[model samples]
Target chain A: MKPLMESERFVRLAAPILVGAFLIGGWELACRHWQVPVFLFPKPSDIARSLMNDAPTLLGALWVTMRITFQAFLCAVVLGTLIAFLFVQSRFLEISLFPYAVLLQVTPVVAVAPLIIILVKNTQAALTVCATLVALFPMISNTTIGLRSVDQGLANLFRMNRAGRTATLLRLRIPSALPFFFAGLRISSGLALIGAVVAEFVAGTGGRGSGLAYEILQSGFQLDIPRMFAALFLIAFAGVSLFLLMAWLSKLALGGWHESEVAREA
Target chain B: MLALNHEEAVTSHEATASPSRKPSIVDVLSANKIYADGTEALAPVDLSIAPGEFLTLIGPSGCGKSTLLKLVANLIDPTDGRLQWWRGGFDQVGGEGRRLAFVFQDATLMPWARISSNVSLPLDLAGVPSAQSKPRVAEALKRVGLEGFENRYPRQLSGGMRMRVSIARALVTNPDLLLMDEPFGALDEFTRNRLDSDLLALWWERKLTCVFVTHSIYEAVFLSTRVVVMAARPGRIYRVMEIDEPQPRGEAFRNSARFADLCRQLSAWLADASLPSPVRASP
Candidate 1:
């Protein structure tokens, strides 16, 4: 019964887009009227055209970055979860080594990227490793907390039932740890993408197989500000897409019953 | 009883628990618990559990009724005296492959498991195959009037339904003794009364020896064949009232004069217990 402009879904979709269009339209008008220098601040229209114009090259670099980010994310999830499992199994082991994990997180990835690049031999592999390190810590801490935070009453029930360690782990601890694990995935996915880009920026790899970071670097050197913006846009879009994909996966896994995933009626 | 740390009050307690027609199964001979920090959690107490007895332990908070249940459950060791089970077995329940189940204050159902799986947990832990356990799980659920809800998860159920699932889980093992620690304290009165009658039905049909812990005097009077009232501050048993009201306790029993009198008496006993001075244990 309401007008199209006033509907909830319509407003939700239209509001941000209208703001974006207004900003872009104003920028384009200012650029044309004042004849703003392209290198100083390119218009949104110029950026869009630049994206299409250099589509193959910028997109190719994006593909490389995406591959590194994906690989690093998978590695971080598996490796970090395994470490968390190990840490939970032994208190002394966790106490001895958890500080090292914190140390890895605190140390700048740029500092480690050079050392990793030097040691790993393959540039892509080194970048993946650097990204994995960046993405690893949240998974470790989140999953550790999840695994440790089993309901005490349930734990007592298991003990009363004479359930063995393996049974307890499988039936109780692992299932309880899932929501926290997925939450870790959401955070670590974004960190993984950021890690890949930062590692690429520090490595500064060139030639045919280089990533978006290198394109960004080259664009800066050539004063191709539009190209740089285009590359930056791709990275931002990919980060958002990755986050959304993780959120979707979390909902798929936990939507049926978990408190965090269940939809509440107002 | 060991003489070193335990003061033997067994003779006096044994003298009090009259040698009746009911055959004693579990004998708590001056059994008491003192924590590691030397705080007396349970003062020296004695009791006897016979088959087909519904015993409710009623007391205020920190009265160690739950601790006594744990002692019966063999979840903890007594610092003094002894808890003898089934005559010279010298073993906890399920130790010699006989089953017993403890229902906690919370439902304690696995949040991730379906109701059927939760009910089947004990059988699974006992290495009973799924094929063999299915019928039994279904039977347990049916006993609790939750037959169709086997596929539902714990979160999908209401508070009372979840507690039913917990009870079904406990019943799956066809336990000889059931230990419950305030299992209905969280529920509203309507649900609590329904569960009380349902529990009584289960008790009658199964002929189970149940040691139930609660703070509610009316609940104690309604569900129990005997109510053991306790006092706090080193947690000692103060009085034991035997409910001689006949079995198959119908709805009318709640309205009877005896029920009100029993409830009032138990309430007064509990109030007397809450007083600072330690009340003498009645014979």
Candidate 2:
């Protein structure tokens, strides 16, 4: 009932939807009124129409991309977390290897995607490796910092209780790292999509197993701009949805107590 | 590594009052803390906390009052001398089926956990399963006068409330000894005063042996059964004074002439403690 009234929650929900509708409606109207060429910049209506016309192929491409993204994101989260654990456990290991982690992050995935594709012998696996490299850095950086960020006082408290290493790691370190871990998830989700798309662009494979990037390349070659726009729309939509999903997951896990998740009373 | 059951804890408490029994819960035999860099944080300090005593350590910043508390809590190893916890025999802290708790200067609550979870942290660290520790957590919260706040997060509560939660966390294990490091130092004056009395009530009810560290002379005077004054240079004890005020110390006590006189004396001790060569100045 309170959400339905003049609260910030009401405004937060309505503002974005209303503004997006207005912008899209205006773009559609202007395109039609000005006799704009669809090739130059397709109207929202044309994009929507193309979406329906190419629904099956476009969605299949979307599924391929999503599958790669999921695989990469999962690998990044797991492998990155393990790396963070290693770093947390041993200062010597972290010092010896952190620079290399940074090197992997800074090197362009596009520059290495072709080599990976050549070496891996499987296009899907190659795309996943590239995407994982792109998504991996944030997870390592955030989780390591989070694991190291235990409150000094609380650390003392644990010591005073004579908590063993396993107890400290499982109970204290893991919970302390959750907020930071989820924050990394939000960033990595989008990077996963970007990485997969970039990898596909470099791979340029054109069988039925192609992802949205291949469809995009094909549409470009044929001058089918509307279909390209439709694919682009799907990618953008997917990224946004992934972000919202992670934000929701963060809220679900931490909303009861975390400062970032607890709803502001105002 | 082990904890006393409720019955065992009660029996221990009863035995504590026996004339034949030793009154000291902790004996700091000339304990000192020196960092890895050879900088001395505290000089050798000898002190003993008797059962059910409220002992406050008051000193200026950089004094080793907090260092002393940490030594007793066994959070850090002392550079010199022995620190012992009493459990029939003088033994190390944390493994004697003996319970003690420490409240840090900051609330030190896990921001991602509910108040109940924060309070149950010690029990969890001690490996007490949640099914068994839930009632103890609830009782601790009740003792802190925060009965319905078990579900709230640390951030949801105000500063004063957060301190109460910290105290509740300290109280959850039915600890025989409690160490507090300026627990109410961050609160507003009114809130501090309110919490001051609330803390006293809890102390009186629990009959806890508390070693509190604070910079405020008035706070040290009001809350303590004995106030130990410390001085910085190498962080040594300056003086120890007993405040013979009655239990459940309240507003009347706060406004009493005796309270003011004691505060003045403690303040003088602190003032002199901070001066360069207080003995030289006196001479």
Candidate 3:
């Protein structure tokens, strides 16, 4: 039998979407009927109208936030991959340096934001560094696990074939590390957006092309509740989109060789 | 087919009537293996494999058949004794020209690589350019009936197909000796039987020296020119049986009385191997 087409599959996939729509619709109707205060949870319709009204400003903030997030995410991925390679290659270094990585992960970006701004002397670089620090640990840990997670039997097979360390690392270990590396990437993408926003919030850039955080702060100060909700929606959308993009990239890279991707296809 | 023809022509030209002038001797002399926890994995053992011979070591689990294979492969050093290879009056423990490839019970394929690349691994390690290794990989895959699966990944293949890919990988190096440690043990019976027959056919065609370790008597008899029966409790050889059979052994041979006789002999030897040593039993 022929399989269901993409449209049909999407329709089948829309059950949760429809439920979510119904819930939002019900909330909007209840708020309007009860004349609830707009400051405390504006209606979806009101938010959508505010989004359209301030489209240019909101889009500009989104572009700024996205740029920071992308730059930071890229830095995190490169730095994390390098650290992971080091961690896998040397046990002494891993033991000594891993706790410092954990310190970076556990220390809130808010606490570090002012310090980073003071040290870097550039607002954009400070924000990027904050986001990178926040997003790097998962990649380091996951990629390290992936590198070390190769099958022992396969290692022996390579050894018996007289494969040198470089060949083993390049041909066997790196490919094995890809899935875990991407998994970490998916998680860190969202963290990067959150980190960018938090860093902007703490840094107090004073409206010099700040991100969604500044927009939200500006609307809160101006008592524009619907506009604030609109900015929040944009941030949420960006976070979800970045996460999905990473997920898609992972599937594309690993789908040809991994069982998880094959199951998704089925 | 072209490579097989070349190998056959070479073998026929070198096939002398007398056995005195064998091309080389791969020897394991009084080898001993002892684990750190005081477990003797393998006792003193002396064995020799002739060039172009197919030998199977049959025993129960933990009989050190695999240890013996690893010792020969130089993957692990024996606690005592020596392994020697003699080629043209020169003796060496291991050298560059002696390319030895090992296939494990697990397919042990690199999960990330395409089948063609995985099969090309040995040659890659040997510094053969990818261009030079491509045809050898294709021929190896063709020999193992995996011709159309060059682009597929290991995770995409069935268990049997993955094992075939491992076999293709072992053959891709064109090594003089192939060592397999229960390579088909994990496969289902039907797949195992089919792989056994395919392996025998490939062995006959390539004239490559093979040292296979298996737990199955029938499989050992069906594939080997000689069977080395190993006993446990500080593993040592119990018996060596030579099968006076020709190439392309089929299902018909498996059903024959002669095949049953060999299987029974190996089984009895294995049983004897498992029992406590009589020298240690006296009060």
* Top TM-score hit: 2
CAPRI band of model 2? Answer: medium
DockQ of 1: 0.58
| C-alpha lDDT score of every prediction, in listed order | 0.88, 0.86, 0.84
Model 1 deviation from native, Cα RMSD in Å: 6.6
Please give the range of 10 consecutive residues that has the lowest summed lDDT in model 3 chain A. A1-10
lDDT (Cα) of model 2: 0.86
N/CA/C clash count, model 2: 1
- Which residue runs does candidate 3 get wrong by more than 4 Å? A1-8, A263-266, B1-20, B88-98, B277-283
Candidate 3 residue-wise lDDT, A200-240, digit = tens = 88876766577888999999999899999999999999998
Q: Itemize residue pairs with steric clashes in candidate 1.
A: none
Instruction: Please write out the lDDT profile of model 2 over residues B89-150, one tens digit for every residue.
Output: 32333443236788888999888778888898888887788888898889888887899988
- In model 3 chain B, the worst 10-residue window by lDDT is B1-10
Model 2: residue A78 alpha-carbon error in angstroms? 1.3
Which CAPRI level is candidate 3? medium
Off by over 4 Å in 1: A1-35, B1-23, B87-98, B277-283
